[model samples]
Target: MKTKILFLLSIIVLGTTSTLKAQKLKKFGSSIEKKIGPKTIKVPYTDVVSYLGYAAPGNEDEVKDGKKFYYIYVWVPAVAPELGVRMMSPVGKAKTKNPIKSEAYTKNAKSKDYFDTYITLERSDIISADNISQDAVDSANWVILERNDDSGEMPKQPSGSSYNSLLRYKSDINDPLKALTVGLYRIGFTTYKTGEVKGTFLAEVAAPVKLPGVVMAKTIADLKAGMSK
Candidate 1:
């Protein structure tokens, strides 16, 4: 009888632990609340673009400050009052719903390897989509809008650390150099600690307004092609 009671207690403890873990993990997106007189209303993003990507061996796009970085090119079709970016690594069993998957990700989706993810949102000076070329991207004046390391709002990493990344950047209409206008942008990702960043990652770009025609790609050429379409 005592053994049966212990087994039941173990089950109850496990169920409680799982419930606590779920509570600690926040959703992938963000929301804002407005208090209208007496009632508070939650407003979620109208448009969210998600990408499922995998960073494999020798797949680093660039190296900055001695850290290897991978980039997901973004083309903003319209002006956005605010832009939110977030990244989760070792995607685990997180809810993807329907995300645009890259070839690399599809090929290695079953791999058990994952990593700690750090991310940045950067906007380039090339405002016109027609001028988004390899040379243009290389020479454009790039501004780092936001950088995030370990976000408390994301799911905890395998090491039980809140090492995911999230950032919200509001447009500065007065500052032409830092405004989030219709232009080419990119999400830069790497590891917070100086080491390899091989793993599957889920990234999302969201806007409060319904900004249509926004597109993203893993390469400049692919982004240009997506823009043309």
Candidate 2:
């Protein structure tokens, strides 16, 4: 009788631990939808590029509406029908594939700090790859295509809230400015509320089609340099 009681207690404890571990590993990425007869289901993207970055003090690109902003420039080499962008802060034990890391991120990979992520996908007027000079980038007009403050699909933050950001923008062929043409784009990120944004983050950009030769950089000069290669 005593042995049976001990065995039952161990099974219950193991089941509880497994449940908690599974809950902690619930992470969602960008996805599309497919129809199977009378039902529709979402499918994750095949091509995903991840970037791990760190936002330190006094390293913001600009400040708007009393909030500090940072940007990651991306060069789209081909036209795509849809694009997806998402960001999560404090990048805790998350597994990523071949993620690009910045200098700050490499230096602070072990830092235990993060922030509430707010993100936007913007398209610039510079369309041609040959015209991606610094002068053109400086004079280019950028238009926001999508913005996300809190995403339920994202995993919960340390604060137990889904404050991460995710957005999917479909190209509008009717509108030239809104179309996803071969051009320059950027991922702008900041905090949802007015406060300092300091932490390690994982940001990803995905597309339904294969986007070869896509370049991502931390600044305009870096983006231009990548395009020149």
Candidate 3:
């Protein structure tokens, strides 16, 4: 036991790091590299010509029983064919009520996984120390994301931004090393957006995120244990 503890500590020590801008841990077996914030905005969401989910023009009327949903949509950038209506959506989740074949659109379907398909900004401040206790993330509008030429929200979902479970701390020392504990996050998704699983989806469902040792540990474990229900 002592050996294991020491090993983890050693890894943390040699693996710890802080940058002038943001503190980040070395990609040791237990940490994620972060570029701390007060970050600049490169792509204002306005660049998104058209969005599909509830986040589009008519968000109010998109809900049912206090919920809204959005799906894959087309985005026409200012740059013409350089980028056309590229389809996008979250990946993950086996249809709760169906036996349909796997769909590539099965990409990250988590309430949080939004796609801007066009150029967007970095959605930093994802989870932080203070508001970490507030399980209101899923309903928290949208997160600015940055990939290549595109970045944007997960497109509002019909969910309350609620989910099957909520993220929580498993220990006195919140395991920043892993994802938000082991339970399913109560991400409120609008019924409309989370459509039935079909053979063909715009994008694939979301895959589990493997952010090195720390984040992947619990997620992988939960998956192995038949979580994500």
Candidate 4:
């Protein structure tokens, strides 16, 4: 009788642990649906824009900063003329100049005329148009921007004007997505003067993974053990 009781208790404990693990994993991802453009901007232009939904690792109310950004990764399988990408703020203006063609846009960027802010990769330098080869998609120029500033003011440009256009925001306002002010922002792509070629491109957003402190600690410990030679 005691053996049967012990077996049942073991089963109950194992089932509970499995259920907890599943719940923890689910908390790390939240589904989102957002897309913009494919509308013709000019009278004869057929500019198309499409966006892919990305899952952030937490609830919508979570605050995201420079350390924790909602990254957008773009892949263009074919090349086209006059292609440019920018992030549009909720107020219907380009928040930053095109990171792909920094030279042509630097004059405006320096004056803080068109866009007062910009985004850059946490890992690598922005991929410029000159760097992309015709044969393959340039993964190096993938879209990653810092979150917008909270001060409602344009960040001050540096002295001597050796503009690091990629670094636009003050350090304090680096967290662009705060739960209270979070809203849909557009990641735009323009393919100009290409008549009916039907070139392909993709855009996807990446949100950080949120895990409980205990779960995160265990994950770290496991990674450490695995890495130890």
Q: Please tell me which predicted candidate would have the highest lDDT against the true structure.
A: 2
lDDT of 3 by residue, 20-47 (tens): 1111111111111234486533221111
Candidate 1 worst ten-residue window by lDDT = 22-31
Model 4, TM vs. native: 0.21
The predictions' CA RMSDs to the true structure, in order, are 3.3, 4.7, 21.9, 23.1
Give the Cα error of residue 91 in candidate 2, in Å: 1.0
Which segments of model 1 are wrong by more than 4 Å?
1-25, 28-33, 40-42
TM-score per candidate, in order? 0.87, 0.84, 0.19, 0.21
For residue 13, give model 4's deviation from the true position in Å: 61
1-229 in candidate 4: lDDT tens per residue? 9999999999999876653432221111112222447643222112323231222224122123422233333322222222222232111122212113212223233232222223332312222323323222223332233432221222222121211111121112334321111211223222112212111112222232221110000122331232232
Query: How many clashing pairs per prediction, in order?
Result: 0, 0, 51, 2
Compared with the true structure, all predictions reach lDDT values of 0.83, 0.84, 0.25, 0.26
Candidates 1 and 3 compared: the better one by lDDT is 1
Number of the top candidate by TM-score?
A: 1
Candidate closer to the true structure by TM-score (higher is better), 2 or 3: 2
Worst 10 residues of 3 by lDDT: 19-28
Locate the minimum summed-lDDT window of 10 residues in model 2.
20-29
